[model samples]
Target: MKLPPLKTLPVFEAVARTLSFSAAAEELHVTQSAVSHRIRQLEDDLGESLFDRHGRRVALTEEGERYLEAIAPALAQIERASQQLRGQSDTRLRLAVPSSLAVRWLIPRLPHLQRRHPDLDLTLEMLADMPVMSERLADAFITIRYRQRGYVSTPLYVERLFAVCSRQYWMQMRESLEDAGLREKGSGRSIRPEWLSRFTLLSAASVFEKPGEDWRRWFQAAETEMPPTARVQQFSHMLLAQEAARHHQGIALSNDYMLDTASDPELVRLRTHEFRTGDEFHFACKQSRAKEPGILHLSRWLERQAEASGWR
Candidate 1:
């Protein structure tokens, strides 16, 4: 019965997952000092440093990773068991999604899902890259092309990227281009594919895809030369690039999955050109759990949502 404060284990996992004390604090709804103190206590009880502190950056030590592998599943099981004991009928599923996709796509529709199925509880794990398949990390995943083999995956949508910018920026650019006689009259659009040279390009990378590849392909598909990146902005996720665009930073390339016309009315999309990459997002889960009623329900819901979104 020699156990450390059981409550502190989650604090450790949060810090390891976020890799920042401040981030972990925000996620746990506690102060940084409180998080640090809890970690100190846990390390003292374990007689080993679980995290390597390097100023603002933090990483899990070797022992920390092993400990997480051991205790995380146990914690999840305890939570599920407690729910059952309370006579709850909810079937909770942990779903791992790319960070940008969660923020731009899944989060907004969460309310609809809850209203539709109250018994299906979901915990979303935002990831910067494709996650390795593990029930401990997530019960299911939304990833690019199966990320790993052996899982049953279904196509969500083919990636279709187009140019997007703040409505105000586009208006200003339109007037300037018109005055300079650079804009074509009767074209019925404020922009042309070749006009991209006038704007900075914002690129994003995720799921092992190249950040700048879409932009280049978009230009090529339009028979326009690729614009120079004299003033380029690169982001680790599409959500950041789109946020930067919303602030009038630059024109960003984004797909339909990451956009909602009603979400950001101030953002204008140039319908002049688009690049349809054959790549698609897929809904997946472990083969062993594929037959579970909860997994089956979630998978069908996701497919229907994708279909309703006009993914062709």
Candidate 2:
């Protein structure tokens, strides 16, 4: 019963999953040379090529895809079993964060975090489709609530959301107002807060307790009310709402972390006001594990990330 080298399995898995030798090395905390060596060894042992590399790009060979399908489930099961055995040890943490934050900010920074703490292992559970809280969901959570029965929380930052829309939408709306004789024909002026009352609002349903709550708060911050006849289109996630805004579907609420103005020149932030949601995003862990080495390390690292992002 000759099995492939046990050490090479993880290296193979990381490379197959990411399809990049450099990314797999970063994920596994090994040098790219080590990753290449492992891949060569694995291929030698298996008597098959796993990847088809074209210059700097790589794709899994047909054999590699089939191998991945077989091993991926086994790896996942092994990880789950290991976590169950490890309990609440800080070294292996299952951290949950809001989906929007995870996508826009956290995911991109993960490699750096891994680089900082090579010995630590992290599994991120995104909170878009999942319920926010439970004793068994994750070892730590990034959340809006500060107090939970058995958890101690640390604040990350208060959320300040601003209205954003497609530049085309703004221009068209301005042109319509001009046609109606509501403004000087060619003046480049900021849109008034009341103008939003007539615009379609793109709503992210995940963040609101009830429909229009966010818009209500935002409108009040601008010294106006969300008009009764205001049109609202709801998306299950904030990213979806932002995408809708980019497509000129409607105006959506967003902030700096999520809005890459340079890449998304089509999306423009409304100049009138930004609404600060007083609810601070908190990093929380069970009271018994709050002082655990892994939890403390992760918490402090998160603080640095938020500060560096200038959102604190």
Candidate 3:
């Protein structure tokens, strides 16, 4: 028996996979007529109808489906082998992290990685719009959430939230005002014993639904009620909200990891009361890739880094 042309196989496979001549044509950068011609040639050679046309749609025949199951993996392996032979490991490391963590933690440390591994290609994408990680696109991901039961996750750090204010604002309150006056200006027009209501509360937009709770939890832990007239300014990204807080625009409740004392001297911790959100920073990868060399190296390095940073 003679074998079909190698080129025709790809065309048939594309049409079979997509179930649309136009779709396959678009993917292959060819005309629909060309795709149809290729499939016709392949079917003539094999003496079998591969698809059942239903008006505008198409479905694979049983033989076509079985052929695809056998061919797709072989084709993929061929592509991978070709890439490997070309000395293209395709070692693209894509990391999806929260904007705050990207800004405060990862970006700062990336310089060290760059210096150490100049050949390594890394793509850092901010995960502000997409909250769910460990999806199809990413190689590794970082998230702050409650421990998931089934997935293998490594705890990078625990969240410790406290109130932060601008140093200049604190000084202004100290100089012109007594404790009572300071309390009045900080919390709200009317000062209560807790004094949290005096200042505006800066928050991340998604803080309400995030696994670790928000400012409300912190206030509760402090045994203080939220102020009635408290102003809340929401930022799309937590990093932006934190920057706003540092500039004394408002008081923000955030974790220590997100604060960079070197960059923003105006930012000062307003409260000594540390509250736990029961949520923690985590590094997660697919269970299949857990034992992969690159993944293992990254996991161990992250664990060591977290330990050195005193993340509990």
Top TM-score prediction, candidate number: 1
lDDT per residue for candidate 2 within 90-167, as digits (tens), equals 388889988878988899889989999987899998885445455346778998865878678888878888899999
RMSD to native, candidate 1? 7.4
Sum up the clashes in candidate 1: 0
Q: Tell me the lDDT of candidate 3.
A: 0.70
Model 2 ranges off by over 4 Å: 1-90, 129-135, 178-189
Give a tens-digit lDDT track for model 3, residues 73-186.
Answer: 567547656876897754456777877778777787777666655655778778765454533336677876424443467889887777777887656544444555554444
Off by over 4 Å in 3: 1-90, 129-135, 145-151, 176-193, 209-213, 231-237
In order, the Cα lDDT scores of the candidates are 0.80, 0.83, 0.70
Per-residue error for 105 in candidate 1, Å, reads 1.1
Which candidate number maximizes lDDT? Answer: 2
